[model samples]
Target chain A: MSKEEKRLEILTAAMRIMHQEGFEGFKMEDIAKEAGVGKGTIYEYFESKNDLFLEMLRFSTEQFITGLENSLATGTDLESKISNLSLFGSKFLSSHLNLVNSNISHLSLPEDSKDQIKRYWEHIYKTIESELAKAIEGGEIKPHIDLKMAASVIIGSLNQYAFKKLYGTGLPPEQIDHQAIARMILQGMQK
Target chain B: MSKEEKRLEILTAAMRIMHQEGFEGFKMEDIAKEAGVGKGTIYEYFESKNDLFLEMLRFSTEQFITGLENSLATGTDLESKISNLSLFGSKFLSSHLNLVNSNISHLSLPEDSKDQIKRYWEHIYKTIESELAKAIEGGEIKPHIDLKMAASVIIGSLNQYAFKKLYGTGLPPEQIDHQAIARMILQGMQK
Candidate 1:
């Protein structure tokens, strides 16, 4: 098999194992066995188990960003762009709840790894920020609204909802009725 | 000292140590030393480390609930009551960001312990729900607004914002301006 394809296969297997067994429980030997690769073969691609797991997260997030950018590019107006983005986010969140939950959000990491995660988050936020700025410029939203705070609120609220789904069970997720929640947040509940 | 006073002192010391070093780093020996009690005396007060830690959370949250209830009781109108409750919530969240960051929201405990936490949260929500219901009945809110969803949205959104604060660096929180956020949520940004 091609090296790139083999690497992808290993990553997929790693994610599955990590999701089921958690970060601390994951072992490189088990992953190699699960992926049908020689133990040394994993070392050829990744320096350590930490690298393999984090790279999997990076790969998934990069794909998500690319999908988001493509979706946003299709819409002209800020409203439609944001609408599409939030819908995409909702579906993405529901589909990858396991990945999101598996992210060791609390664990301390090596400096370089920590920086990579920070940059990834910053890039995503900047993309959202620009969209918000466009909406404000287009007069779709109130002129004086703090775009940063609004963006933070939007991102924070949705992420929190997703976090709640991961940790607890209550609110029906976006997959069940995307339009209802999208509508509720976009337009305040007041009459 | 009296039994209740000694128990209170132990819990206070436990909280201080846990907040500084986290649950994993929270050693029984340190707690006993901080509380000025023999290691065995800790068992006299609480059966185990997990039991002591969970009680620490319950003690703080109960104090928070009592403070909020006092604020709510002072107001007659639904809007005023909600406003007071929401403000108290924002303040409480800012103070307890670390506790939430530690995943206290999703803490897994034994059945009775879990039930105690659940009852505490339910009671908090129940207070707000009934107050909102009364407001709807009194026509304080718009006649058509869904009080249940509205209550959830308010509580959920505020808690979500507080959770976000723990994830990223921002203005030193003193300048976070929850008052302004409360204003926007209660009254829209629209002119």
Candidate 2:
């Protein structure tokens, strides 16, 4: 495998271990075993457990962002773009519920790791903000609407729904109507 | 002081300590001192630190709910009622950022305590859901709108904005326009 492919393989293995064993129970050796790689090979890619976990977070975040970009490219209008983005977000959040929960509960993670995660969130927010700006420029949404607040609200509401589905006895993630949610947000934003 | 007043005093003191020192650094002795009560006096009301913390959570939740109920009572129309509730929610959340963050990070808190907190969230969601139902019946909001999802989105969006104001350095909590947020949500929910 290519070096980049090998790194991706390691991250995938690490995510599985995190989901199965949680952050407290995570062990590097177990991850190596899961990935069919030697312990030394894992170390060569990551300096420590924390390093590996941070990389996994970054990898997942980048993957989601790429997916969102792809969705945006295919969507022709403001509502379609937002609907696609929300759907992607819902799927990503539901699938990574364990990782999100672990991040919430494991407050002892290093400051740098937390900062990195925060930066990733900011990136997502910026992406949404840019989309909203495009809608406004296209005269699809009201110019008076606060893009920053609008972006946060859209992302946050979708996250809340995804969270309820994942952790609460609410609708299953697949059953949620992403189009309906997008329509609601569009109604709120449109002139 | 009356019994109820004394209990409120203790809870207020506990909340202050939790905010200032966080959950990990909280101690009953310090709370007692802050409340100007004997250490044993605190035990008379709460069985232990965990009990006291849970009670604090319950106490705050009740106070916010009471405020929301009052808001609902005074508003003459559906839009006014929702605006009042959203404003109350935004103010309450902005003021209680520390408590919220502590709850998110302090996963070591007992399972029952966590469960109790979750129950409190459900209670709040139900309150919003009932209000939405009232609006639907009055033809103020669309009947087809899902009350559960609508409530979650309203509360979740307000929460997301409050969080950004509290932590994002974008705006101070006091500067956030609660009414604008309420108006946006009302637009989305209105028939």
Quantify how close model 1 is to the true structure by its C-alpha RMSD in Å.
Answer: 4.8
Residue pairs in candidate 1 whose N, alpha carbon or C atoms collide under 3 angstroms = none
Q: Give per-residue CA lDDT, model 1, range B1-191, as digits (tens).
A: 99999999998888777655554458999998999999999999998887887787788778777966876797775455655655665566545423432134433456686567667766766776677666667765555654444554455555545434545454344445565454444443333
For model 2, the TM-score of its B chain against the native B chain is 0.80
lDDT of candidate 2 over A1-191, digit per residue (tens): 99988887888998877666654457888999999999889988888876887777777778887977876777988778867876777677655523432223123456787677777777777887888788788888778787777876776676666566555564566777777777776674222
Model 1 bad stretches (over 4 Å): A1-120, A159-176, B36-39, B67-91, B97-119, B135-140, B163-173, B188-191
> DockQ: which candidate is best?
2
Q: Write down the TM-score for model 1.
A: 0.71
Interface Cα RMSD, each model: 4.7, 5.5
**Candidate that would win on lDDT:** 2
